[model samples]
Structures are given as C-alpha cells and as structure tokens.
Target: MASNVNIEFRKLFINNEWVDSKSGKTFPVINPSTGESVADIQEADEADVNQAVQAAKKAFERKSTWTQMNASQRGELLIRLAHLIKDNVSIITELNTIDSGKPLTASIGEVLQGVSLLTYYAGLADKINGQTLLSDGPVFSYTRREPIGVCGLIVPWNFPISILCMKIGPALAAGCTLVIKPAEQTPLASLFIASLFKKAEFPAGVVNMVPGYGPTAGAAISNHMDIAKVSFTGSTEVGKLILKASADSNLKKVSLELGGKSPNIIFADADLDYAVEMAHQSIMYHSGQICCAGSRTYVHEDIYEEFVKRSVERAKKRVVGDGFDKKSESGPQVDEDSLKKILDLIESGKKEGAKLHCGGKRMDRSGYFVEPTVFSDVNENMRIGREEIFGPVQSIFKFKTIDEVIEKANNTHYGLAACVFTKDLETSLTVAHAIKAGTIWVNCVNYFSPQQPFGGYKQSGIGRELLVYNKILRLSLLYSLQIKTCKIILYCLTYSMKFCVYEMI
Candidate 1:
C-alpha cells in the first residue's frame, strides 16, 4: 500500500489499516472556507467499495468481537470514544469549518451533538431488549432485536459528523458492522473520527469508511448482496435512486432522511420580537443548508408588512464571511455547486415576480459566498416557494387563518419539519396538530436532541433516527419458541382459513 500521502491523507480506513485506494487515485479535500486544498484522500471507485464491503461482510460473518461482545462493553467503548471527541473538540470544529465552509460555532455545536449521541447510545446499548407478548395458546412468542449484519451508510456533505454518529452509534450499539461512504466533499472529520475509534482500539473491520463519489462507491455499497441494511441521508432525488438500488440488490432494509422545504408560520398573536429573530435564524443557520431548514415563512396578513420589515432589517445585520472568523454570523455554502444553486434560485425568484428584500447578489470577494437573501409577496405556486434552494435565502408568504396557513404549508411534497410561533396555547395546539410535518417546533426552530426522533411525514424521507422510545418492530422467529397443544392451522396447498381483526387509533 502507498505510504500516507505526505501532501494529504493517504489511505481509506479498511480493516483497521489506512490503505490506498484500489485504483491509486487521490483527491484533495478542499477547504471551502479558504478556497485552498487542506488534505488529500484516496478517491475510491466501485472496486474500492467492493473491498470495503467484503471486509465488512467478513467481519460480520466471522461473528467478530463487535457482534459478539456484550452490549455494555460496546457501550463503554462508545463512551470512551465520546470522551476522546471531547478532548479534540477544537480540532474537529476547525476541520469542519475548513471542510464544509460553515461557521465554526455551528460546526462546534454539531461536534457536541455527535458526542452526546455517542454517550446516549452508550447508555442505551444494553437496554435494547426484545419483549414477550402474552399469547392465547401454549406457545411462547418473543421478538429479537438482533443486528441486521453489515450496514451500508451514506452521509451527506452537510452536518457530516453529527449524522455519522447518528448512523454509527445506533448500528454498533445494536451489534452491527458498517461500511460508510462519506460525502466526497466533506470526508476529513469522519476519517479522523473513525481514526479515533482505532485509538480506542476497536476490532478490525467493525467500522470502515470509504470516501468517494455517490454514483460508483455509494452504488457499490447499496448493491452489495452481503449488506443487510442501507441508511442514507441526502437529497430527495438521490434517496429514490438509493431505494431503487437497494431493491435491485438483496432487498436490504432501507432508511432515508431526505430533503425538506419546511415552513415557519407566525400567527399575529406571537411575540413579535421573538418571531422576527426566529424568522432570521430559520433560513440563515448553517447558511440555510440544513435539510430541516424552515425555508418557507408564512405570516398573518395583519402583521405581514411589519414582519417583513423587521425580518429584512435582521437579515441585513447578518455578517457573512469565512467560517473560521469569530464574528461571522453566516458562512458560505458548502461548495461551488451549492453557491451556484442558490444564485440561480435568487434570479428565478426575481423573474417570477417575488420582490427581493435584500441580499440578492453574491459576495464580490472570497470563496463561495451568498448574501442572506429574503423574498416577499411569494405565491404558493412560485418556484421559490416550491423548490428546495438549500442556501441562504428564504421565501415569505402571508396568510390570514390557521387553517389556511396549514393548507399552504402542507401543499409541498417535502414535510421534514415545521415551526409555529404563538403565545396562545389554544392556537398553538390547534395549529401544531394541523401542520403536517414530521417534527413541529412550538416557538422554536430546529431544536433537536439525541433523545428526540426526527424524520418526515411526506416525500421528505423514510424511517426515523434517534428515537428514544424503542419501537423496533422485530418479528418473532418460529424456531426459538416452544409450541405445545396449539391449534395447527396449516392449510398446505389449499385455501387458508380467513382471519379478521379490528383496531382503533
């Protein structure tokens, strides 16, 4: 294998060793914050993915220490890794800022979020138990929540570390091995994080990361027959492609946390000042690259002009610059593609007749910067309202009644999250129930913990992550139970007996 690329990172972590890409191709990990190359990583193609999967398959099939170890022991190891992360928090923050071009504060918060997840799952590792159901016959039935073998997880360029922990901690805690495909743009921190696991002395092949493009490497992992589960976090179009790939292969279990154009609604009764502040944060956090960003804002018709003016002033005050800068409120989008997409949307919004309040132009200097832009008089049918821009721009609409606003918000295919700001409990409760998103925040925007589950209701995605209450639907295996003096209702090669049951919600 090639020695560690002194110019950059040399190897992709496979089977506990840093090995060069099978193809011997190398790519630079560019710092979007500075528009400079910071590190180099092996650019793995399909062949590299195959090697990673084979190692993961071997690790799982051999009943490796990761699978056979006691849950408590695994949890303890996870806690150790979490502590390791705590010590190197500043390094992680800097890496994330340089890698994905988001503010260092946001990256630091994400690193902490990841650490908390590891610690939380560490406590939960031994708690994943299968429950027994009271049966009528002399047959005992119970469910087993066993790990589903090698998991192929693909994380996005945004929020790399936190999402990585979300996928890694749960799967490992449940006794599964992994083959991760980090986004090609932002793979540095994950590589370092996985290296920390090596420092913590995890068994070989328990977790392998291959940094490569989505089409070849990611497809190779999804289409691997030995992979029993697939977990992905990305755009809506890509999520569907993953589903198709999973179905084309061994029909592995699939979980997706996809795109969103979430709504933030402000009733006239809301705290005006707080609403204005939240409205600014709803789209500007992480440069509005967040998947659950409240990109679409709705205000009551009575307070529309006031909300717009205050929101515009607040948007104007946002300082945009390099993420490493201490005083920067907003940073550039992740890379060039993200910046271009945001600019295109801004032009389209102006053409579609939505009045640009401020920040319609890109920054004249530096790497991949867009002004925190806002659009007003946005119609529900406009592209700005319907599309997921994934940038530092938000489209605002005005509505009169709670029911009407709910209808407008739910009209989109993406329903990842929604936020409502109101002091009246009755109106909040009524509006919260009606807003058809996976997560609804009352007087808050993007409040997530390691304990609370987050997903979507519509085309936003499939399956959830970080659910505290264990609702795993594990089906019981027949051979493990003892059946005695039970009615054998086997109708082989004939019509089966009819069964019917009624359930209430």
Candidate 2:
C-alpha cells in the first residue's frame, strides 16, 4: 500500500490548475498511523478562496461553456469522471487511508460508493424536467428549473471523498459550478479527485478545491456574496456558524449534514447475536468517527446483561491497528486531538459513574490509536450516553418498555439516524414511526446507498442529500412564466380586461 500511494496533488486547485497559496503558507499532512508528517500541503487562505470563487463565478456565467453545455453533455462529463475515479480506486483508497486513518477496505468502499453516486446523478441529469400548469383562460403557464449558479461545498474529514461526491454530482448535474473547501485534516483525497475532474475534461473552473483551515477558507466560502448556495457536512457547531455567515452575507441557500449521537435499540426478542454484531459495528466502525454513528445503544432490561457481556467480549477481541493491515478491524484516530478527546471522554464516563466494562485507555503503541472501549450501565444523563463522542467508545443504556425506549431515543437534540433490531414487523414499524430521526433502519445499521435521501429532523442538519432527482431539483431555481395567445388577447380587449386580470392573478 505504501509503495502504491503518492501525494502528488497538494496545492490549491483553481481554474483547473495547481498553484501555491497566495500567502505561501503550508501545513503538514500527518500520517495518523505513524504520527508522522507525510507531506506539506499548501494552505489556502482568504485570497485563494476569492480566486477560486471568481473562477467558479466565471464558469457559471450564462454564456460560459459550462453553462451553455446541454444537460446530456453535463451527464457525460459526470459519467467520465465516475469512470476515472473507478479506474484509480486503489491509489485513492490508499491516499484516504493514509490521510484520514480509515481502514483500506472502508476507503475503497467509500470510493466505490462515490462512483455509484456520480453515476446515479449522471443518469438523472438529462431527465430533469419542470412542470406545465393548466390555466383557466386561454393562456399557457409553465415553470422551468435553472441552475442556481456557483456553489460553495464544505466537506468533512470523516468521509471526504464520498461526501464531496454527494455535493458535486447534483451541483454539476444542475449546471452549477463549485468552489470546494476540503477539511484540513483530510484534504488529500479531495485534491486528488480534482485532478480526475480535469482528466474527465470538465471545463476549467467547473470544480475548484481549496485546502486550508476552516476559519480562513471555510469562512470565506460561507461569506462570499458570489456563491449562490453553500452545502456543508461537519459538526453542528460549525453548521451554525455557516448558517449565520450565510444570513449575514447574501443569505445564500445553505444545506448542512451535521453531527449525530444516533440510537440503536435492541429488543428482548431480537436475534441477540446479530443485534450485538450490528450494534458493535455501528459504534466501532471507522473508530466511531462517523457523524451518524449509533453511539448510544438502548437495550431491553430482559436482555441487557447478556448484551453488555457480549459487547464487552467483542470489543476485547476487536483489532485496533494501522489501516493498511488487512486483519485490523479498526484504525487509529485521525490525529492527536481526536485521540485526546476520546481519552478525555472515556475518563468523563468513568467519573460520571458509567461502568467501563473493557478497554478505556489509549494503546501503548505509536500513532493515534485507542482501545475499543465499552461502557455499560449508562444513563441518559451520563456524558458518555448523551454527548457525541466521535471515537471508538460504546455506551449502553438499559430500558424497560417500547415507550420507555422511544422516549430515551428521542431525548437528544440530534435526530440524524436510528436503528431498531426486532423480528416483529409491527414493533419495527411502530418504533420507526415514533422515532423523530430522519432515517430509521430496521434490523440493520450504517447501510447507505446513492438512492437514499439522508439528512436530519432536528439540530442534526438542514437539508437532504443523495436521491439524485430531489437533490438536483433543490440545486435549481424555479422560474415561472405565463403567455397569452393572440386570440385570448383580442377576446380580452374586446370583452372584459377584468377577466384577463383575474386569470393572470
């Protein structure tokens, strides 16, 4: 994996060209698996953001090639981009693993998912259509959907490439250009994908990438007047800032996919073995760095003890090591800060009186590694059960009845996602409808697809992503028009103009 991986694209990508930051400043990209600096990436600042936004503005101009291209042609470009990504999956996977500390298999899966997403949007590009309304009078009225102009896409570190594609596919299919700000922790995969956009023959400035800290480049994107919309995926705190910035500036359309402390409910009648495994993966996969990870597990009191015992045993046996290793089930945290935060949260759980069943300390080995920790006998008030601990820490809480579990599940401000494990259909549907989350999974966890629309119901996020048709429609503007025939005009003038006025209204 090391031999195949290369950090070739590190500079800010503007107008289909690689260039140093205007500030000439650089930041080191650390390899979390080794706690070493892999490469120095050019840090994009406000000036670089302005340049990229200008490029996107130009590309989105009415007469520009990107705007003039037919919908089918845009779809072709996306298909080509998807192909290019599929062809270079290995290197991108390696880059993601090295940059974000995700296991190599998970990175590859995300890359493939990106391809599927692009392809889905590509198919929907030419199929977009507007509505024609029937008028009471001899007049024709219709609505046409047009591109919303240049968009600012802010990607998160947890799933950079996949989330970037989620924004890019629909924006391009809607004929909008983009200026992307990749997360500082993991910008390598995004910058590399920018090169693939060029290889796909996408017009210059159609896709631009600025790699820098959030306060600088990200703030510029949120506050930029030229950007028509801003789509962000990250923490809920940062999402609030972006919303405020948009309101303070041009009031651009903002869509956010934010943080979540999702609930995974296990009933007494559930297949205990399968439920345990799915619940474990829900919290443990990607070291619990996922935004919608099921960090809170609610178990029925009848099976609570057995579930806790099995979960602890599973955590004890789980592998936590370098991402490149095939046998490793989990990888290191993205950086030292994440590692420290997880450790601190684990300590808080202990202090708050949640029973730490197993694995509460950081690994003694190098790199930002932490043990797969499990805490049982957790309550709703406990920090471990309530907080969004974005780490390999699992918190299990005991519940009595269906109503009790449902109340416990909806206690958090977050309503991103939840899962219910049960063999009975009535119970599944009952819990699914009772839950306030945007997505409810029955007998499963962490299953995602391109066709599924994902977002949140409360403080978790603002808008939906994927579901190509709806997403692309949201990226467009609806323009309504009315036209009267000559016969109708003559009749109106000869008879009563009030009729025409009423019809128009």
Best of the candidates, TM-score:
2
lDDT of 2 by residue, 54-163 (tens): 99999888899998999999999999999999999988989999888877878888888889889989988898788777778887777677777788999998888889
After superposition, the stretches of candidate 1 with alpha carbons farther than 4 Å from their true spots are 1-10, 468-474, 478-505
- Give the range of the ten consecutive residues with the poorest summed lDDT in model 1: 496-505
Q: TM-score of predicted model 2?
A: 0.93
Query: Tens-digit lDDT track for model 1 on 383-498?
Result: 88899999988789999888899899889998788888887877777877777777887777776667667788678887787742221222446424321211111111211211
lDDT of each: 0.80, 0.85
Best by lDDT: 2
Residue 181 alpha-carbon offset, candidate 1, angstroms: 1.1
> Candidate 1: deviation at residue 200, Å?
1.1
- Alpha-carbon shift of residue 273 in model 2 (angstroms): 0.4
